[model samples]
Target: DNEIKKIKAEYVRSFLFENKLMPSTWIVIRIDGCHFHRFSEVHEFEKPNDRQALNLMNSCAVAVLEEFKDIVFSYGVSDEYSFVLSKDSKFYQRQASQIVSVIVSFFSSAYVMKWKDFFPFKELKYPPSFDGRAVCYPSTEILQDYLAWRQVDCHINNQYNTCFWMLVKSGKSKSEAQSYLKGTQTREKNELLIRQFNIDYNTLPIMFLRGSSIFRIKGEDSVMPENGTFEEVKQEIILSHSNIIEDSFWKEHPSILC
Candidate 1:
């Protein structure tokens, strides 16, 4: 019931911010779980291999999506599902809260029915390891960026690999590496950085170390050497890593692996 209310509040908040709600408003909603928990009696099924557990999570997502079909386009069911509204106008603005209310009710009712079938109420507790929440929302540029990054192959470039890995590692928490990179100061530099690190790049290391080919280098402050010395390049590469680590964003959110 509490969770349901929380979701309802989120829906209201989203609608209020969007404003201009008339009809045919396009929106995307997504929901997913962060972790999985099994009932005490289902301890044997607690491991990640339990198909039944996976199904239950999927079922929850499906139920939410089905109930909101009129306002949603497609939903991705994983740890989260996304809903894209088909219309461009917001005719359902007034009912936004009600929509969320229905979703909450659906979640509570579904959880009760599904959970009771496998274990007693007293034994029912979220699996000890799950920290994820089911989330739904309209599409945002952030989502697009995330999808694009996910599609890229990280293995081809060491810098790209490192940055990608760092993003994921940091993403385990709520810190905003993606947004920080997208910010104005770092946007252009970050773009070049990503390109140089991408698998398609001709010389990933050269691009990574030289920095000038990728970023502006001026005098002693420059990341690369005009003389093209291997030792200088190597030192620069090390410096780049250090600079990335010391970045205000990265520093605030250290890599989980580190």
Candidate 2:
């Protein structure tokens, strides 16, 4: 039996390829919703920006941060999120597949589990799914650039969606809305929203404009009422919608990179 087990283990494990992330480099596991458009449509999600859906995403992200201590930070918008693991992390021995799968699977399950909490009256039409990929950024500078790129994407997509939905709600067919928005620059879109819809694009919620950033900070550790002998510091996860592309955020949260 031992000889047979050894033979099977050697043969089967040999077929499994290892995809280890680069050492001394930050690991970014980005997960995106699979076919979220149809899911949203079937679930009757509010167009442009669904507060409940966005909140649910935020909650799931918070849960992920809480579960994975090695994940230093996360940035999310729309139906996708990018989680950044510390460069020195040894989680799953830095195996790209394990890290990506575990995070994505946990996030997907968290979304499903927390759905009812956020959308108390609405039933989830189906189990929402996500796809994930892992990439290594060799330096903090490159990681910042990657996050900035995602945030910029979030801004652009949000602006377009806001305009598109506003036009549709104003009785314009979806085709007409698309045509009107086509070839229109940022300036033109803002003009259209103000002139026609009286909506100030800048006045939109910061969460929609900048997306959400989840991370941990050192704070007072909780203790039972009777065990007040001493106080200690502990890591507490927090969510923010501030501008991560700027230096001030990094300066304020210096421990994130450390």
Candidate 3:
């Protein structure tokens, strides 16, 4: 009995060494696909935006939101998604390692498991994986800044890709397109897309440009017409591609933060 107890105690005690994240702070875990460039090529994804691939990613994010109640919102672009936990959440005691590991594992597994549903004819050559890291935001301002930074990155990358592809289609060599685009400002790119390609930058699909945002909204309680009985309804997760940087978004979804 003494030897058995010692073994159990030693193993159990080791887990506690991983520290929990600071409480009352917004915890965001961002996960990105590992080596997705090669994965996309091997799978022959459609350029600019692949509808099936993006849907598969969104489905995985929804699964994560359903699995973890503490995650109030999520924003994803390309091969990466960022999940935000409410400031007051105590899920898993905010244990960073456990939280990160569980989310990444679940998302990666879901991507693999649900591939068939999204891509019926295509084959999944092998399992795809993701890497995740958690960061604690001390204030809403800082959190918004982080979110804004990501959105800016998405804008820059999408604009560049749009120009590069248009140039390639317009008979410019890949290296020529690369050289021509180097050091060109955002205005130049928009003008090029307009004058040369006849593609208006503003008319692009919002999803491809802005990426995806997923957040929950509370449901209003309902009253029965006959008996005057009241019933509560479950909240819902809403997926959108609207601007998240402005005050209007935070004001509308006040429950997302805390």
Best by lDDT: 2
Error of 2 at 183 (Å): 1.2
lDDT of 1 by residue, 67-91 (tens): 5544322222223333344444242
Runs off by more than 4 Å, candidate 1: 1-25, 32-45, 71-79, 88-91, 94-96, 117-123, 126-258
Candidate 3 error regions (>4 Å): 1-16, 222-233
- Show the lowest summed lDDT stretch of 10 residues, model 1: 209-218
- TM-score order of candidates, top first: 2, 3, 1
Error of 2 at 187 (Å): 0.7
> What is model 3's C-alpha RMSD?
2.8
Model 2: residues >4 Å from true position, as ranges? Answer: 1-5, 220-232
Two-way lDDT contest, 1 vs 3, winner: 3
> In model 1, how large is the Cα lDDT of residue 40?
27
Query: What is the full ranking by lDDT, best candidate first?
Result: 2, 3, 1
Which of the two candidates, 1 or 3, achieves a greater TM-score against the reference?
A: 3
Question: What C-alpha lDDT do the candidate models reach, one value each?
Answer: 0.38, 0.93, 0.90
lDDT of 3 by residue, 76-129 (tens): 999999999998888888899999999999999999999999999999998898
Per-prediction CA RMSD (Å): 22.2, 2.8, 2.8
lDDT at 226 for candidate 3?
Answer: 70
lDDT assessment of candidate 2 = 0.93
